[model samples]
Target: MTTEIHVTTLGHWSNSSAGPTTSFHLAADDAEVMLDVGVDPVGRLQAAGLSPTDVTHVYVSHLHSDHVGGFANFVFTRSLLNRAGDVPLLKLTIVGHPSVLAGLKELLRVQYPEREFDLAWVECGEEPVALGGQLTMRLVPTDHPVPCYGVVVETGRARIGFTADTGPVPSHQHDFAGCDVLIGEAFGLRGDVGESIHRRGHMTAEDLGELVAATRPKFVVPFHFGQEYADADKRAELLSACGAAEVTTVDPVDAKPVIIGG
Candidate 1:
């Protein structure tokens, strides 16, 4: 049961990067799961040859425009496609804290004045979410200004852990241990004010290096790059710092989409 995890970069790091976002597509043979739908995620899905209708579950990291920018679009697409009877309105499960969900509702009212949903919100205080088959998500708190949660997502044989936005490594680093792949946030490069000046909403490249040092995942995918450094150098620096993990940076648009158990 070797599970496969596919990652697609819906959001990449560029000088004029409109949305500081990334979309992950993790699937197992037949089941499909989308993680962190943000900043034109629906458009990114389309660009990756997928539809919002294909997404079964969406696991959010934290409540930031970059992370959740595509929520309204995803919801709007789903609502437009599923007309209360179109294919039974695919069960879209959003995993996050209760307050985070609340904040989203407030955001929706402002973002999409004519938006509604026939979905379920899983406020993962402690209980994990079973995404129908071959997939489950367990949440762990991360170091962010607001209440944020990282995810330990397991689908068949592949386990992908994500640290959305963290100041540095999570204190509970052991929680996401033994994952096949880990996608950590590297907002800014080392020696840059990305560490010293940011309001703790994002992290610096050095901070992600700490994540690699603390958690030894097989592959470390560095994402959420700030407009300060080239992703290539940032990845190299992070990998060199880890010394044990294979680090890869995902280009939100060009990176391959992960298809599990295929």
Candidate 2:
């Protein structure tokens, strides 16, 4: 009865990186979900061998540009493709906090006033949202300057947790507990500088390590790193901190699918 969930980090680096921001693609039980749109999500999705038309749902964690900058493009591209007869216009569901959804809708209206797309908007809250088939998702509030949320997606046999972006919040330990795979943010290394970032609503490697120890997910994937941390040595240092918690740590590779479960 084990379910295999395939997760691909479409974009792992933070805004500082001259690359894609933060986005993840999760394929489970016939559900194709994107954790965040980030910038150029459509391009990244194509590079990962996934067609935009195949995506069933997109979950936005917050309103940060880095996390949702590409949403307009995604919608516009889909509409354009349908108009070109390249694909049929399918209804796409977008889930996010009410505020985030409102803002994104306005953004689309402002960006493309003439185009109308097939999109269903769902506001995420404490209730578990049914995502077709046996898949369901629950949203948890995170500690950030702006309103943000983390998500836990359940696929019958496995639960996948994603900490979109946030500072150290103790409640997360319980929120993400028992997840088969937990994708947490480790924005920086442990040090004085890291402490500053932590206070600004971002987790450092040490913070993520502590969470891993407490939540004890079967597998932990760390991401949302600054460009400097992308260096091999710095990346190793961050992984070591998480490994110290005696849990398996997986480094997210852009566009590479990491299979979770048996």
Candidate 3:
């Protein structure tokens, strides 16, 4: 069987960025998954030519505002579409850490007391789990100030690794070995304060470069760029340090989805 992974970058910045926040759309055949539903994810989804209802599974790496702030919006929008009586409510499966899911439920309950949305929440751990009937997913703990995880998605032929938002978790490299594409964050450029960056639970350009060098993914897609490193040169400098043969930086110039097959 041939499996295809289609990854679209909806937004590529941390919460602080003036632009849309970081989010990714990963799809394999008929299964559509959202990597992280950042603030205004619905708008970002539309911008990327995707509908909110098209998302079947959502895998959140952490509970930061940039990652889950738009959870209610996504649910509400999808609910509205269902209420219009034009289509059935799309079943949304939310996967996240136990505590994160708990907090999310409370947040939703508090915000929309009168209305209930059609969705299911799955609290995930470090164990590998099967998703969408074909993809295999595993969450590995990452080096962040708060509890966070790096997601690994694999099919029979290819694997995609997402660092989410982390400083450095060298042991996690083992989980990402030989991935077809590795999406890592570059929160700051080389001259930034290493301690400060790590303290904020983010990675500097050098940090991501080191990670790519260690993991050796076939392709590296750097996103979640800090304001100072928004320029392509800054991103290029980071990739140069990675010493990888193929590195891709997604920007306005090239907003097309990256396709990987297995």
Index of the highest-TM-score prediction: 2
Instruction: Give one digit per residue, the lDDT tens place, for model 1 in 177-239.
Output: 777677777665656553563466566666666766677776766677655444556546644
Tens-digit lDDT track for model 2 on 1-262? 2277888888888883557889998888777899999989889898888888778899999988999999999988866665666556668899988988998899899998988877899887878888778888899888889999999998887789999899999999999999888899988787725488866789988888888888898788888887777677877888777654557788775345778766
Error of 2 at 120 (Å): 0.9
Model 1 TM-score, all chains together = 0.82
TM-score of each: 0.82, 0.93, 0.90
**Can you tell me which runs of candidate 1 are displaced by over 4 Å?**
1-3, 12-20, 82-88, 112-115, 194-201, 231-254, 258-262
Query: On a 0 to 100 scale, what is the lDDT of residue 33 in model 2?
Result: 90
**For model 1, where is the 10-residue window of minimal lDDT?**
245-254
Give per-model CA RMSD: 3.4, 2.1, 2.4
Superposition TM-score, candidate 2 onto the true structure: 0.93
lDDT of 3 by residue, 22-140 (tens): 78888776668888888988888898888888888888887788888898878888777657676676689888788777878886898788888778877677787776566777887
What is the RMSD of candidate 1? Answer: 3.4
Q: Count the clashes in each prediction.
A: 8, 0, 1
Q: Which pairs, if any, clash in model 1?
A: 3-157, 3-158, 4-260, 6-258, 7-258, 9-252, 27-260, 39-70
Candidates 2 and 3: which is better by TM-score?
A: 2
